[model samples]
Target: IAGRLRGLSAREARRSAEALAHELDIGPWMDRRALPEGGGLSGGIRRLTGFAMAIAAPAPLLILDEPTNDIDASRRRLLWDALRRRGDQGAGALLVTHNVAEAERIVDELVVLDRGRVVAAGSPARLRGTQDNDLRLELQLAPGAADPSELATAPPVRQRVRTGRRTLLTVAATDAARGVAWATAQREHGLLEGFTLAPATLEDAYLALTAPGAAPGSAELDPADPHQETAHV
Candidate 1:
């Protein structure tokens, strides 16, 4: 059944396998009929074969579910490169992954699903940029510190406090610029310690959208406004 879809005979499949081995940078294994030591070669061979078979089928669209699983980081990077190349040449791919960082790198579009429903869909930038008002700020503070209630109460901005030796502050997206400025001013005035701004990420959006029912001081999120809600827990 697979052979028919790939348009290749057994002999042709073997030849195609050789070509795929090279494409996946596993050409050294192609010369040996037997798998290599520690079973690594067999897995590599299987992955390369599947990848090659997908490419050889002349399909306009390819769907991969967790292609990077059980693969080393280097090979994972190669796989993403291959997919991106295919995408650039006008082929469409539906990639399902929990690895948001990898998805952010290669996928032009994103469909976020929650409980088998389409919760959000757009380009990566568009989806992530939806929460332009939210900012993640990391602080470096002295040990045995108290809560940041002083800073939190200064502005009318909604704040969620994560306390440790250092504090992680989540401020409203609209208040980010002003909030950060205020924090920096406090630091300069010996109120807080060192700090850095963390980049906003798809993970942030996912958490906010999927967090359980809201608690006090946190607003109930609107699914339509992907950016305004605080990530609980």
Candidate 2:
């Protein structure tokens, strides 16, 4: 299969072998037909080679499993761009990735697995649109920062204080716009330095769906336990 697809012929194969070596910027490695042990190319080079080999075949459907793994961020972005371009050209691509941010950026659909079970499936926007959790705001205070407690007085629903050199604030998703308004008001009042708003992520959706009762970073199970099981001995 490899021979036929890679276009291996006595003359054509030799030419392709030479071309592949030159294309990959390697010399005399085609004679070995294998990368040097402990002297192999970088992750990006290997990934690019694999991608080139796949593109050389010009297959209709490309199944990439963790194509971005071990690749540098720049190369990962390049690969993503290439995949998107391929998809735009009507090529079918199935990308399996655990990086929610990357998936959000590239994937048109999502299939979530939990405990070996297919739990949820949909597009990224659809999934995120279904979530009701409020957006989060992180406020970075400048040097000689003033307290934000004044802005916290009897304001909105569900606010939490996070102390750092700067303060991090968590609020309900519905309150995001209002929170920004409040932050702006605080800025006017000289109670805040700078602020950022973050939307709900795929990780949030996964947590909400898979472990509804589990607190973030807390092992203490929810008292309003829904998934709590009474196992038979």
Best by lDDT: 1
> lDDT for model 2, on a 0 to 1 scale?
0.59
In candidate 2, the residue pairs with backbone N, CA or C atoms under 3 Å apart (3 or more residues apart, or in different chains) clash, namely 133-173, 134-172, 134-173, 135-173
Clash number for every model? 2, 4
* Model 2: lDDT of residue 187: 76
Full-model lDDT, candidate 1: 0.62
lDDT of each: 0.62, 0.59
lDDT (Cα, 0-100) at 30 in candidate 2? 38
> Residue 190 in model 1: shift from native, Å?
12
Per-residue lDDT tens digits for candidate 2, residues 1-233, read 23347665666555654555455444343333335652456665666557655654445799988877777776677677767877888889888877888988898887776566565667765544323455657677656766564354524533333355455444567667777887787777776777888865555455444553423322222234443211111
Q: For candidate 1, report its TM-score.
A: 0.64
lDDT of 1 by residue, 18-83 (tens): 666666777776565554543545565566556666776456899888777767777777777877
